[model samples]
Target: MTERFASLMERKLPMLDRLAVITARDQYVRKVLIPMFSDEALDSEVRTAFQSGAGGYIYQVDTLNTAELKLILQEYSWADIIEGEPQLFTQVFHVVQHSPDEAFRAEVLAEIGPYAERGEIDGQEYALMYDRVELAAGRQQLYGSQLECLNGQFDVHDLKDPEGVDARRASMGMQPLQDYLEQGRALYGPC
Candidate 1:
């Protein structure tokens, strides 16, 4: 090894994890812009169409490319970010969980699967990660932990097996699915 590498090994400092930087940028976009605009709000960030006459309505628009441009940059950045081998997935996970980059968060969760399964990491984190990914993918979450309600009912997309999901959850260190949902309802108002 070179002298610099030898010194690095001795000190045990993380050598510039580019993935962390990428994750940070993505996180900023998610936490700031998406939440600020409620995702859909950005669709009409600078434009509104109102019917004036029977003929048609003109759109009051300004900087229509803003949101699209931001998304394009994010997508491009992700491609480059994934090109390298990421060593600091734990850090990446922290950044992603707080951010709305659900797809990237799911990717990080997938990377953590082996560690989580082997008891190297908290199973609750693993379960939450699994739920996040499923919810992101529009699937019935396996844990049935995270939930939302519409019309006084849990808005779970489509849970796979209502009968035995708890067994699956317990294997990954989670409460029984029914118990989880009941708690969820209590906390989130019948959701």
Candidate 2:
């Protein structure tokens, strides 16, 4: 088990590094370049580069997803991995979001909540996974912090059971929802 975990980490870390680079580059082209040069005005080479970058990032996402699926096929459970190797579960969860399996994400979400309750994983990681699973399922998010600016004002994605949000955040080592919202507004607002 130790040897297997070590090998998995060795492979995952490098792949994650490459994935981040390609994904960031792809985002830069979409968010930065497309705005600076309108879609029709982009040079062919620049356009092609953006297309290729997006394709490459998607390919990497597929590769990572397949790798994670293999890991899931193993006998390991979330608690086993979190208690033994710790960060492995978190790393897997990061790329696992790209996977199209709602059932699998739900499974992880259910399985990990107890571990988080036991302090097996940190609060931020727990909150992130919780918010992600909920949002992906088209349900309300627990943390009001996941915001996108609409008209320069930060708007909370629909939140589930908003009344208990601060307690949820506190349980997961997060600050109050209002405090997070304040920061989001300051950063994404003034409209």
Candidate 3:
């Protein structure tokens, strides 16, 4: 990921929760990650998984173990059941309000910078990181107004307005992470 994009994400969304869901079908493998974004359904899964004592929010599975998941992917032709590079997946959703406090921003930058520097994340991933931060910040803005307090401050107007929020949610729901990653893999091959 470009330094510019990383900087943006740090400036926007400082607090984030990352969830990685792994599934396998036959010989094909996939990993779905929720990149600091929130959706009711996704949140519920995370919460339940956590409450049920799943540690670290990472789900790992063998291709031979999840026959149903593999079958589902095959049905959509999103992946071929073959040994190959593991695909990275993530879904971005739900905007929440966030504070631009210097300390908070610094902490976020510290956490993400190393990964970007190592090439573990690319420009697109950086962009998605920023997008999730913006969405969260937007939600925080709404909450602030409802509470009659301005705890979290953000200047991105698109996320603060109702129309913008609806638009953002719609866009997020339009594509599943599996589909998005499949398309990207097809276009770019193993990134």
Candidate 4:
């Protein structure tokens, strides 16, 4: 890591480390742990245990992490947490993006604009959240970064202007909408 990155991380090590732990549990439950339990080959009883136990754990952590992250955002700007270490943006953004509060997400979306402009955070990250906020508000998304699963097929959410979407996405360093949808389909198959 760069010197600034190391310094910032050390100063905020406790918060950042805790975020890492939360992310690990979050991803594990959704990815590896849940899948292990849901395997059709597994006994139903074991699956039930995983569902009750791990599922509860996910809810508990999500609530706790959301509260903690909200407090952190109240205390610090995104630049304070992410200016030196661009990578740290992922940790903070993951929490903000997954937050159940649409209002909070919208607030964070506004907060991120200047940082994205200054190149402190990835523009794609900003674009993703922008699309999410727009979709939540029943407005058309500009960058085509948000996708929806409609009738078991994943497709980009409605765009503000279909003709300008590719240019907007490119401005944010994102690929064409078609390429993004194709990649998602390739990786996750139709859902």
Candidate 5:
């Protein structure tokens, strides 16, 4: 299944790449871009139409045909996309959902600590932490203060590999704290 998904992704690379460019240009789509254009669903022709600038994209499923391929890509619901990536999206969605106003601020707080300790968090691993915090925050699954403290201890040190850091940070907003710690600990850990 992974291989098939990978192959499909390869085939849809052009469309995905184009969609990414469009999404980046249009901040409105930034949140929903991942769900709408995940590697799994890219094979659907409807996705292709929207990615290619067909008619007009709609946020509503009724407007988008699970069967038809002509409908233009429309708006996206952050909730809907988060539903798709329950593990990660749920976390982010919940953080924003329950707290409504304080989500992003909380995120900054939660991330600051770990970031300080480790110096960085790779995109993928951070996604995991984001999801966890989102779930905790949204569902009240965990103590908010605990999360805040944990994130606070993180001390983002100088990037040892400036070149690599610049490359990844340029592409993605930030690196995962786990990755940074793993690398740093491996290099600097007591022998």
Candidate 6:
């Protein structure tokens, strides 16, 4: 890496560290907390503790991370982040994904499309964020990357042109819809 690239990478380490911890906790919520809540026999006290503790952690961390990321994005663009690999900016994507600021996410979504097309950012990441933005606007997602868990069942959010969703996902370097849903099911429960 060039000196500048190395310096930028070093600067991203703290954000990456935060993303790693938040992701592990998110996985725990999906893999453990959700299932525990689904169980008809789960103890009320245990469920309440996990709900307030784990759920609150995700909320708090995402809030802080989102605020930091918004300032970072204001100072940088996709061009500034491009390095040897598209994943150099994965932390940015994850932060935007978790951000509650729909307007900011939408702005980043627009800014990243060209980068994804140029292969400077991961297309799958772009697709995922695009789906998130679209869904937040109460519109159908072009790529069915966003999933929801209602009750004990998991499924893709409303998708546009469902019949050709796999084709759209493929163009974005994503797995087929069924495979994506199945993977989410593996982590989050039955689809």
lDDT of each: 0.51, 0.63, 0.32, 0.76, 0.37, 0.73
Residue pairs in collision within model 1: none
Task: Between candidates 1 and 5, name the one with more favorable lDDT.
Answer: 1
Alpha-carbon deviation at 5 in model 5, angstroms: 53
Candidate whose TM-score is highest: 4
Model 2 residue 170 CA deviation in Å = 1.7
Q: What digit string (tens of lDDT, one per residue) describes model 1 on residues 1-191?
A: 49866665443333234443555554554445433333233334232221122112111111122223235435443323222323444444444554455666676677667777666666776777787788788776776656665676555546678677778778877777667666555543321
Which runs of model 5 end up more than 4 angstroms from their true locations?
Answer: 1-26, 42-44, 54-173, 176-191
- In model 6, state the lDDT of residue 174: 91
Q: What TM-score would candidate 5 get against the native?
A: 0.18
State the weakest 10-residue window (summed lDDT) of model 1: 54-63
In terms of TM-score, how similar is model 4 to the real structure?
0.77
- TM per model? 0.48, 0.56, 0.22, 0.77, 0.18, 0.75
By TM-score, rank the candidates, best first. 4, 6, 2, 1, 3, 5
Per-prediction RMSD in angstroms?
10.6, 7.4, 17.8, 4.5, 18.2, 4.2
- What tens digits encode model 4's per-residue C-alpha lDDT throughout 1-191? 59876787677877677667766755665676555654656666776676678767777766677788777766676777776667878767876776678898999889888888998788898988988998899898898877776776668868888998889989889998899988776644444
Tens-place lDDT digits, model 2, residues 1-191: 89987877774565446444544443454455334433545676775676567656665655555455545546455544554556655655555544556667677678777877787777677687677778877888887656765665667768888888888888778888778878756542332
lDDT of 6 by residue, 1-191 (tens): 49987887787676556546655544454566566654545566765666567667777766776776666556655665555445557855776787788998899888878777787778889888988999999999999888886665678868889999999999989999999878777654342
Clashes of each: 0, 0, 11, 0, 22, 0
What is residue 73's positional error in candidate 5, in angstroms? 32
* Ranking 1 against 3 by TM-score, winner: 1
For residues 32-151, write the lDDT of model 5, one tens digit per residue. 653454334354566555544522342332122211211111233322222223343323322332222344435443644354245343344343344345454554211111122123
Residue 33 in model 1: shift from native, Å?
A: 19
Residue 97 in model 6: lDDT = 85
